[model samples]
Target: MRVGLYPGTFDPITIGHIDIIRRATALVDRLVIGVAINRDKGPMFSLEERVAMLEAEIAPLQQETGVEIVAHPFENLLIDCAHDVGAGLIIRGLRAVADFEYEYQMVGMNRALDSSVETVFLMADLKHQAIASKLVKEIARLGGDVSKFVTPAVCDALYKRLGR
Candidate 1:
């Protein structure tokens, strides 16, 4: 089976992220949204909370496509996780040039590890091109609305965490 692995910190799993996963689902037999565990970054939501929020956001799409959203607490390496999941394609969402620079390097390293593995870059919708998890959290913390950028569950989680 051709499985596409969409991996990211998903600090909160924005709508933009969801759009990419949704589109990727149509292109692959299986889509696994891998939530990378970054200890240094210090997650806004606890790993459990983030996973729950992601599950809620992607549940509908999973129901539609037989896809699944699961959290893989990855602190070691991306290639290791990909190999563990038997992913042949790495799905990444590109919002702008900044993301390209980072993703390009990752693609090269991933390819080096497994020449058969390929990275599939998907462009974010123009509306969400600049949306990112950190920015969303910052805006929400300052009492700015980010409901348009993130899912309802994520919005609620942010507010609850911030005591808003």
Candidate 2:
């Protein structure tokens, strides 16, 4: 089976993420959503919460696409996480040129570490391209509506987290 790893902090899974995941399902039989446990970032949501949010958001996509979608939390290197998940492909979502600059360096480093695994970039839908998890959290924290960026469930979780 062709397995792919899509790694991210996923503090709160945004619609943009869902769009990439939905499109990525077509490329792999199983898509592992790697929820990174990067303490350096000081994410708004815990690893458990992030995993739960990813699970909740992708369940319907899995059902619709008939692709096995699983959430795997990892604190180790992303390349190592890909190997752990048996992913020969690493899927990344690109929002803009800024994202490409960072991802380009990551792809090079990951390739240097493991030549066998490949990285694929999917462009976010134009409407959702500007929707980022950090921005979503910021808007939510400032008492702004984030319904357009995230699902109702995630929006609720963000608000509950911010005590809004």
TM-score of each: 0.95, 0.99
Compared with the true structure, what per-residue lDDT tens digits does model 1 show for residues 83-113?
8888888899999999999999998988888
Model 2: residue 57 alpha-carbon error in angstroms: 0.9
TM-score of 2: 0.99
Model 2, range 1-164, lDDT digits (tens) per residue? Answer: 99999999998899999999999999999999999999999999999999999999999998999999999999999999999999999999999999999999999999999999999999999999899999999999899999999999999999999998
RMSD of each: 1.2, 0.6
Please report, in order, the local distance difference test score of every candidate based on alpha carbons.
Answer: 0.85, 0.95
Go through the candidates in order and give the clash count of each. Answer: 0, 0
TM-score of the candidate numbered 1? Answer: 0.95
**Most lDDT-accurate candidate:** 2
Candidate 2's C-alpha runs over 4 A off are none
